[model samples]
Target: MISGLIMDIMGLHRFAFHSQVGYTWVILAFVHLVFNWGKVKAYWRHRFRLHPHQDLPTPPKQLQQLEHTQKSDRRSLFFSLLAMAGGFILGRLLPTGQTVDFSSQKTDGGMFYHQWSKLGYPQALRAILNWGEQPARYKTYGDARQIELPDPKGYQGLSLESAIATRRSQRDYLNAPLSLVDLSRLLHLACGITHAPGELRAAPSAGALYPLEVYPVVHRVEGLQSGIYHYAIQQHKLELLQPGDFRAAVVTAGLGQNFLGQASVCFVISGIFQRTRWKYHERTYRYVLMEAGHMGQNLYLGATSLGLGACAIGAFLDDALNHLLGLDGQKEAALYLITVGRVETG
Candidate 1:
């Protein structure tokens, strides 16, 4: 079991079988203890010298043996504690040595990152150095014009099961304008602040560090300008980044997907790496992409629940989309795109 655990921690073996072995070992250990319950009880009493009157009168040789055993146990416990304390102190005092840059490694990039980010003893110790002030949770544009989105609550939509059953990647959309309320609800259900005190959202984030920024490139939303706008999650409002038509640019950025131009709103999801990177370190890339997936699924279900169409786009020109969103394609970069609009039904 110990060997399996070590292998799993080091990313040297699959954890499913290792975990099964561990669980089975635990069950066997439990059964062994059950069968030896009386022996275990007697040993515990002898070890701790509990209830001396209940124990048999010991021979002089047995008495000496017990004394020696007690002394050895005491020494073992003292040394064990001392070793733990010394290890902790050394880990804290020692500077982290040079870490290999996984990006420059000749190994497969994804596998290299996986192995490098594996949480082992050394990596856990190095994490102590990563502690400090956390980055701001929300990205804001204070000077940009903000549009008040309608109260997204109290809208009766499809049941959860129905939504999941009907949810699909819909690329074909009708040439009709989407209502402002529909847009409001979509954004709300996607990543709105669900718990105000904790600043939690509709989608779960790693450590609640919401690194995602949502930008809606409006094409035909009613009572809204045709331009790019950021969703202000804290205030539940839309912040207009640029007020102009970008249908052509969005289609080009989306690799000439005509459906992007046809959709009423194309949601661009970007991740601010430092938000999660400060805490997660090497695992930051994994967490940010996972958070993006959570947000994307929420959008998919939300669109489906509202009886609208939504399609996720992954094959987009990253640099082009980043440039369009005024992102530097480093600290904050576009990760995924989902286009939502009205769809024809039979």
Candidate 2:
């Protein structure tokens, strides 16, 4: 999937190739499941039936039984390798003349429009009529300590035009700690609530679903311990989620981008798709990604206005980041990241 996405982003027409690979992968996966069905069933049975206080199952009893188990393991490993080889051969032997015409493809404004067009008229009508009420505006994490952000209205910053004109993807940062005030202002401008009465935010949302959530990984912020923190939009506060410096892990997850470790703080924007999916259905995915882009721009501009350096990052290990932030990949997943810090000036 990641390979397909990279190919698409680079305008490489390899759909036929990817399709063959996908078919081969499915075949191998099916064979694997079939071969391991016995073990799989036993594992699940033990997982469900065993009491919490019960001891783990003992190993094979006799030497003969142990030898038999080792033989089975060897056979499984051999078959797995054979399946991989077969898959490679099958993928290579498949026809590949049918190439996708990237140039001739019609752009229907965006993917959201294309997805909407696929829905039946009756379903579309029902969707519009039954659009569910907005979900909770703020996300809270148990009894985590919250630090209220500074009032955004009182923030002092450069003009929008000035920020835009001078904005750059800054990769170099000074070895200086970011002040709490600067961090608060940056978060407020990026996604914090702008109007409390209407539940509106600094960034616009499709249908006001506002599916995006912000998390800041602190490294060198003054008056704050290094940890992962979630932003609560309703109260405009930061809730501590995990406490520890994770700059090294973050850099590894970001494909060894040393600059990420150097930054004072990194903002990770995640999406909870169900919020918008209730109304837009499949179109919600497109809207969620678009929302991330909007927030990225806001972060860049916000950082620029505050005389700080910022860079938006997209190339990172998805699963690694999801694990680091303690988010389930399906429900709430990391979509984008931005690193911010003071720019070094000689």
**Per-model C-alpha lDDT, please?**
0.86, 0.81
Regions of candidate 1 where Cα sits further than 4 Å from its true position: 1-107, 128-133
Residue pairs that clash (backbone atoms under 3 angstroms), model 2: none
TM-score of each: 0.69, 0.65
Task: Please give the distance, in angstroms, between residue 319's alpha carbon in candidate 1 and its true position after superposition.
Answer: 0.8
| Per-residue accuracy of model 1 over 50-130 as CA lDDT, tens digit each | 335346777878678777887787788789898777766765565443333444556455765676686657567446455
RMSD of each: 15.5, 17.8
Q: What TM-score does prediction 1 earn?
A: 0.69
lDDT of 2 by residue, 173-284 (tens): 8999999989988888889888877889999999988999999999999999999999988888899999999999999999999999999999999998788877786567
Candidate 2: segments with Cα more than 4 A from true spot: 1-135
Best by lDDT: 1
